[model samples]
Target chain A: MSLCVLEKVSKTYTTGDLVVYALRQVDLTIDPGEFVAVMGPSGSGKTTLMNILGCLDVPSSGRYALAGKDVTAMDDDELSRMRSEHIGFIFQSFHLLPYATALENVLLPTLYLERPVDGGKSRALELLSLVGLEDRAHFRPNQLSGGQQQRVAIARALMNDPELVLADEPTGALDTTTAAGIMRLLSSLNERGKTIVVVTHDPEVAAYARRVIRMRDGVPTEQPSGRTPRPLTAHPPVTP
Target chain B: MRRFISSLHQALKAVRAFKLRAVFCIASVALGISAITVIVAATEGAYRRAYEMVDRFGPDAMLVLGGSAEARAIGRRDKTITVQDVEALRQAFPTAYLLVPMSSVREVNISYGNRRHQTRVTGTTEGYSRSWSWPVVDGRDLSEADVKGMRNVALIGAQVARELFANTDPIGKFFFVRNVAVRVVGVLEERGTTGAGHNLDDRIVMPITTAMKKLMNEKTYVNAVRIRFLDARNMGRYRQEVRAFLRQRHGLKPGQPDDFRLLSSEEIIRFLVALTGSLVIFIGITGVMALVVAGFVLANLFLLSVSERSGEIGIRRAVGARRRDILFQFLLEAIALTLVGGLLGFVLGVAAGPLLKLAADFPIYFSWKAFAAGLILSMLVGLIFGLQPARRAAAVHPIQAIRSG
Candidate 1:
């Protein structure tokens, strides 16, 4: 079954005297274990698409189905529940709570889930070990390096054992070496049969995905199965 | 239950993270609570002590004194109370518990060997102790023989015992009053100072006959007549009978004013009690104001905390904390702070009572109700003032807050 399906989804935001279209009649679908990357320029609606797919924002008009459940008309509480149970998110800034330790940060998502995840600490430790940060579990965000903090954020995202993971510019703020490490982590998680959607402006970062989709303005220009795209350095990028 | 405990742990952690701010907030609350409790306890203590003192003067006793504005205006200053007036009141009101004709000789100097002191002297019948509730501590009170034979004898006060005799026993000792030596037959127990700071136990009591015959000389009148009613509630009837007897004995017409003032001990107690009650009310109101100021301090502190931790709140929301959870957490923090302050304040208030007694030279009693009031009031302050800041923290938008950081 398809893990996520969007049918003619659109989103528009009105700011004072201007109306900005964040998404325009977008239709997409992903199978249960596919890895996809969305690439676009600033204000090209890639983040907006990630927000809707992550259940943080609803589409202005269209049907969004996640695992055969229509979530287009769900309220705030229901959306939160859906996010807690079915989706996980990683932000570019590695948004770990500053006051919480690494283990405490990883345990954050489980706190909101209705059902308690068994062996929560053990699972959190396993995720931290997977991200190569088991030794730094007690250190706060300020005590960790940028790369370490991002790894902790990734571990936090997977705490609920979500079916799908949404990462927005996951490696945007890291150095090239650290970025490659994060990309490797995401590729391995995707290889483990988790459906992953990553949004990035960097073609090199998007190169790690198995399937890449490009966006111009608010419209998708390349289909997922069109081709095995060349390396990021060779692609002729277009600005919206 | 685990969730509640975890939430409390998280709240305590948050408070500990900002230790100086938390301490300042709690201290402000504690100061206000302590001030309120001490004032309330002190007022209640003073009122209770004053009531006890008034009861010592005999709750059922009434005093009739010669007084009339119209008579004085007409130059009737010689309308003094006679022994006849006392006999008349006793006969007219057979229900009276006791009747005594009394007079005071203010500031009389009495001497014992080389020691001398100026003291107040009261002369009344042998029933004075029964009517006034003054019990003798040593030897006997003035007997009927002393009164009828007009013998020179005296009942000294506790302070007089300490002053004239030092550590020696005062019973059967001779003390000279205006060079006429009188034997002290009894020493009365101590009565604490009055509201006016007069030492009530620093006086001498002599028989009315001896005082009339020897000191004042050929007296046909007394300064005051004291009557004790069989029942305290019969004060009004007893007072009416005494007024009527005096009016008839003085030969006054129907429209003529009364020649004496009938004052009930109940009235004195009531006046003092009411005055004490008003003072307590005033102090209580000031205490409330101080607690309100403490509440405002707490509110301001919480507001500053909410502003400072906006980013943290957003992160928690992003991790799926509901608005109600955030609100409850902050409210719990506020309540915890105030409750701790209230507990500390109660301890300090209780400890302060004896210290205050030592400083003010008067006994200060503590009331449990006052302590309970302080605690309940502090909790109420936490609820009323803490809600606004808690709501503000809960209302933050996760997306906007995340962007702010």
Candidate 2:
């Protein structure tokens, strides 16, 4: 079964007199354990697609399903629950709460759970270690480097063990070396059987994914596979 | 439970981030709360004073003073409450234990050797101590021989003894009231001020016979009679009998106003308590007005905070915080602010007691009940006023809010 399925999704915003279409009628499917990259220039609606997939915002019109659950008609609270339970998101800015320690940010998702997650502390520590930041768990976001902060965000996203991880320009703020490291981390997470959908305008970042989708003016079209398909364990290109 | 605690933790950090503003908010709330605390303490002190007065002057004792509405209205000083009324009251209530005829002159100049002071000088019978429930702390009570012989002896109050004699034993000392040398036979125990701020200790008492025959040179009359019943339960009945008997003896007919007024210690205490109670209510209203203003300022501050932390709100929402969670975050921040203020105000209120005593010579009492009530009231103010800002924070769209920052 597909981890995420979007049928004829569309989103529109009315700014005074003109109506801006952020997403057009687009059908897409992301199967379990699939690594997909969405590549487009500015204003190409990649962020809008990531929002719809992550359940941060529902499509203006279309049926959306995540992990076999219908999310098309969900209300705000229901969407929030869906996001909490099934989706993990990494933003371009690494939106870690500045005042909170890295460990506390990783523990943020469990704060909203209906019941306590068994061994939640150990699990959060393990996730931090998975992202190679277990030693810096007590450090605040400001105390950490950009690469370290993005790693903390990745750990926080995986705290709830979501079905799919969504990244919208996750390394947009990092240097080239740091960005390459983050893409390698994403590739490693995908190798470990975690589904990932990353939105990026950088072709080199898209090279890390097995498949790529191109969007133009809110319309998305799939590119032919195997152009720059690298093995999961292959080293990312060393971009100075 | 965990979620609530986490939210509280978040609120604490937010408050810590803006320490100055948080302190300002707490101070405003503390000022409002301090006003209420001061009022509560003042009224408590007044209540204690009233209780002391009622205790000192036995609750059942009645003071038949020299003035009547008609006498005062007609500008007549005919000695309405005299020794004749005392005799009639004694005859009417033969079971009465004490019927002390009394008179007083305010601000009489008294001198002991070189020291001189102006104080109240009361003239009453040998039953003065029994009727007023005040015991002589030193020396002996006046004898019947002293009254019959109209001896020039006096009992000084604690304050009068302190001022006139200082460390010297006042018993057997001579003090001249308006140049008439009177020997101090005893010293009364220290009693604090009255509810009306009358210094209870700053006075001296002399025998009515000596006062009428020698001091004032007035005979066959007294200013008032203070009566104490053997069985206090029938005081009302005996009081009425005394009034009727006095009216008959004074040749007063039906529809004629009697030339005396009956005052009870309990009535005086009640009047004082009611007066202080009204003052407390007035002070309380002003305090509440101040709290309302503080609440508005607190709400405005929370609104500003919400706007500043919109990005944080969005991040929490994206991490799975519901609108209610966001609402609770802001609400808890407000409550936390007010609770701190309430605590500080309670401390200020309690501390104000001694300051009031020193500044105005007023007594103050602090009760934990008042402190707890003030705290609860302050928190309620936070909750009520915090609703609008919390709702505003919760209503922010996660996508847009997260993007803006």
Candidate 3:
């Protein structure tokens, strides 16, 4: 079964007498173990599409399914559960709680679980180490550099061990070298059988994916990635 | 359960992050709770004082005053009950255990070896000790010889002993009242202060014969007469009979208001409760107002933080926190703040007993019931005011995690 299936999903915003179509009957699908990039300019409805794909929001019309379960008909509570159990989201700004340490941020999802995961503490520490932030687990967001803060956020995104990872401009706040390092990490996770979807307007970021979906004026067109695919375990040129 | 604890932990961290504002919020809750505690303490003290006084006065006792209470309120002073009235009462109540007559001069300067103290000086018979339920801690009680021979001997109250003697022993000491010298033969036990702040232990008592001969000069009228009966169940019947007998003895005409008043333990309790009723009610109103004001301060405090922490709320929701979780977090914050205030107020209220005693002779006592009630009341205030802030916190859109700061 597909990891996520969106059929003619539409989202509209109504303000006073004006109606704006953020997403106009956009249909998309994400299969397991696939790396896809969604490229769109500002106001192209890419954020709204990503929100629906990640189950952070529901569509105004049409159907959305995640892991074989319908999502558009789910209430806010079920949407929260779907996001927690099946998908992980990463934002460009990191969105780390200012008062929480890196480890605490990683453990945050466990707090909302029906029964918080046993050995979750060790798993949080392991994820931090995987993101090269083991030593910074006790540090708050402000104490870390931008790259290090993003690394902490990435570790938190992986803490729940979700199969689908959704990132929205994950490297937008980082330098070119740091952005490349983050893309490499996402690439490595994709190779480990995680279905990854990255949203960005930058072609450089989109080039890392195997398939590219470009959105123009609320319309999406599919294309084969320009670069040849590397082996599943193949190492790319990476920087820390 | 873990989620609830996590929410509480988050609430504590939020409060700790901005301690100055937390203090501002807690002040109103503490003020209201402290006032509540004081009111409870005052009320407890009033009833407790009445109970103790009634016990000392005895259940089967009736006290007849020389003037009517209603008339005294309008500044009417009647010197109607005289020595002859006491003799008449003794004859009327043949089953009475004791009948004692007393006359006291308030605010008299008494001196011993240049150490001076002002106190009430009372003149009474030898049965004064038995009738008042007062016992001597030092020396001996007044004997029949003292009243019959009109000796210049006296018994000192606890407070008068403390003031005049300090570290010196009061027994065998000589104190003078208006140039009439009397040697103290005994020191009375400590009786503390009354509910109205009257120091019951601040007086000197001497034989009526000595006071009449040396100080009063005219010995015809006395201030009050006390009679103790054999059975407490018959006090109501006895009270009526005594009223009729006194009126007849005084030749009081029908419809002409009797110039004297009769009192019992029940009457004393009613008067005391009535006297402290206004004070208790005033404190109660202020206490409730304080709680209400504190609730607003707390609600406003949480509201401000909810808006300020919108980003944080969004992050939490995105990480899978349900609306109930967000609601719990804010509710926990409110309850935690008010509980701290309740604790502070309870401690201050308990300590106020000693402090107030030293400052104003305020009667107070510690009651766990009142403390528990205050705690419950404070928690209620938190729940009532916490709803709006928690709901607002939960209403924060999860999309803010990607958008807002």
- DockQ, every prediction: 0.35, 0.52, 0.56
Evaluate candidate 1 and give its CAPRI docking class based on DockQ: acceptable
TM-score of chain A of each: 0.91, 0.92, 0.92
Error at A194, model 3, angstroms: 1.6
- Show pairs that collide, candidate 2: none
Question: Between the candidate structures 2 and 3, which one is better when assessed by DockQ?
Answer: 3
TM-score, candidate number 1: 0.80
Q: Give per-residue CA lDDT, model 1, range B323-356, as digits (tens).
A: 7767877888888888888877777777876786
- As for lDDT, the candidate ahead, 2 or 3, is 3
lDDT of 3 by residue, B1-405 (tens): 888999999888877777876797777888888888888877788788888889988888888998876778798776679999898888878988889888888888889888888888888888888887889889999988998999999999989988888988878877898788899999888988765679899999999888877877857988898889999899999999999998998898999887899999989789778866877798789999989999999988889888888878877887788889999998888888888889887887777658866886666777886798779888888899988999999988888645875
- Count of clashing residue pairs in every prediction: 0, 0, 0
TM-score against truth, every candidate: 0.80, 0.80, 0.81
Any runs in candidate 2 off by more than 4 Å, and if so which?
A: A10-25, A41-45, A216-218, A225-227, A230-240, B67-79, B88-99, B104-123, B135-207, B228-286
The fraction of correct interface contacts reproduced by each prediction comes to 0.23, 0.54, 0.64
Local error of candidate 2 at B348, Å?
A: 2.8
